[model samples]
Target: MTLNDLSPILLDAAAPMINPRDVDKRLPDMIAGGLDAVLATAGAIEDFRTTMEDVAKWLEIERSGARKIKIARSVADIREAKASGKIAIVLHFQGSDAIEDELDFINVFHACGLRVMQLTYNARNRVGDGCFEITDGGLSKFGRKVIRRMEALSMAVDLAHAGPRTALEATEVASRPMIISHANARALMETPRNVSDDLIRAVAASGGVVGVCAAPFFLTKDGPATLDMLIDHAVYIADLVGPQHVGLGFDFAEENEEDYVYFGYDERYIPMPPWTFPSRIASHAEAGNLESSLRTRGFGEAEIRGVLGENFLRVFEEIWGC
Candidate 1:
């Protein structure tokens, strides 16, 4: 294959419009946007049966097509997808609610190609408290067990939407490095969803990565959520723990935002609608804008590559071991 034919494996840490059926329609956009693989949300806060159904959708997608999109369980699989011009799909979770008291189900999900799992969504669960939880009780005993099991099974844990107490505890308690899969620096913008520098450093010290999200609210309030605003978050984290600890999770939703479902708190039960939650990243095609942003900020090619995907790729290799 020619050099241009086999580009670098550009992975978006948190991509949306990610349903199995919907991915077929988005494949052309992903290719045009220069994304080689994306860690897509497969199940979040759904029941076990619902979770299995979610995974089955991807399985069916892979079985139906030899080329369009496929499941990727390893770094090698992601590389293969890049070489062949296919968007590798890494099934991940935004919360652990789907397992529902089933610790052993971690293994089941892992075997089914689930490579990442978050402890909580936006409220408390069996695993831990989410960012929106008023009580912020933190990680439970079962939550610790879940982290241990995930480490043993090579299923990486995410703390992106976790509460402050839970995020701190996960960083300290995890035997393996855990990721804040998609969040920005709260130092840049004051929001509950934005991560603090303390948590960012803790994640880097734990041998983990922090993926900066480009959501509007997370970026800044001074002006429009431009690519510069996104890099500011990356620069902040990179300044703290070095570029090796920084990465991109854009969290861009291209197709249907309605594909994501939550089980923590009902919108009617809650005071506000979570759908109104900030999603400032304009489009998945904006994925190509990141390289120039990094360069403008004086990031070298290697550093930019790390923030792009190599840094995340390193963490996956350490966890997956293949």
Candidate 2:
């Protein structure tokens, strides 16, 4: 099977948890639902170690089946896994908080197969401020250094939750193409977390791909966003940035109500502020449109192939050179 023939690789650039035991139970259902892969955040190096062990166990189960789960550290790995009818689980970090104040840990993360790392989540960090901050401070001294280190390590720098100034600054400084892995177009949604048109164009100009998110708040305020609305957003981005520069990073967290409450109460885990909590859960129900959008939006095998994994794979190959 080719990437096009395989199921959709739902790349959630930010997920609260990566429990191997939980994923083991979830993967079978996800596979049955035509889910080929899931790219999620480990938060930091510590999280990566824990998540990696769990992923290894999950893949072990797949080893016994006709289908398998493979960790993709490069474009070749993703393609090869697709051809073999396997899911390519690409490890990503959603925020720099897990890294703490140290920048050297980036190298440690790269050594451990971390393919993507974002600068911030929804608040201020050592690297820079998030979109919610009142003052949009651009990349700090340390942030620039971090970008340089990420380029050297060949990790894809993400600006998903970064503020406008920081996102632009990083785009200008990073040697390799970066991604706003999970976000929407601000022009459409009018959310601070969404990227502006100029930033979208800049990312495209830099040969980077923008993964439009399915979060409710990112879509629109009128009502629950259906698959058509999601596709409409994708089409809008494609029109502005070109098709090759757009993809889906659903940002879907498959947690139940209990999980939702647990995360909402946990100050550290919940990236958004208190005001944003209601919208988070309200937005959850509309995420199913993600797959439907791909199928109904006139996105053929090639477009779906690129949106599902190839676009991200190409960028990874350029940065990681693996």
Give all candidates' CA lDDT scores.
0.81, 0.68
Model 1, 203-226: lDDT tens per residue? 998899999887665676555567
In Å, residue 267's CA in model 2 sits off its true spot by: 13
| Model 2 residue pairs with clashes | none
Error of 1 at 291 (Å): 0.7
TM-score of each: 0.91, 0.80
- Local accuracy of candidate 2 as per-residue lDDT tens digits, 166-269: 99999899777888788888887777878899899888888899887766557766655555656777788888977788876766555555644533323332
Give the clash count for each candidate. 1, 0
Q: Candidate 2 regions off by >4 Å?
A: 1-18, 44-67, 254-301
Q: What TM value does model 2 have?
A: 0.80
Where does the lowest 10-residue lDDT sum fall in candidate 2?
Answer: 273-282
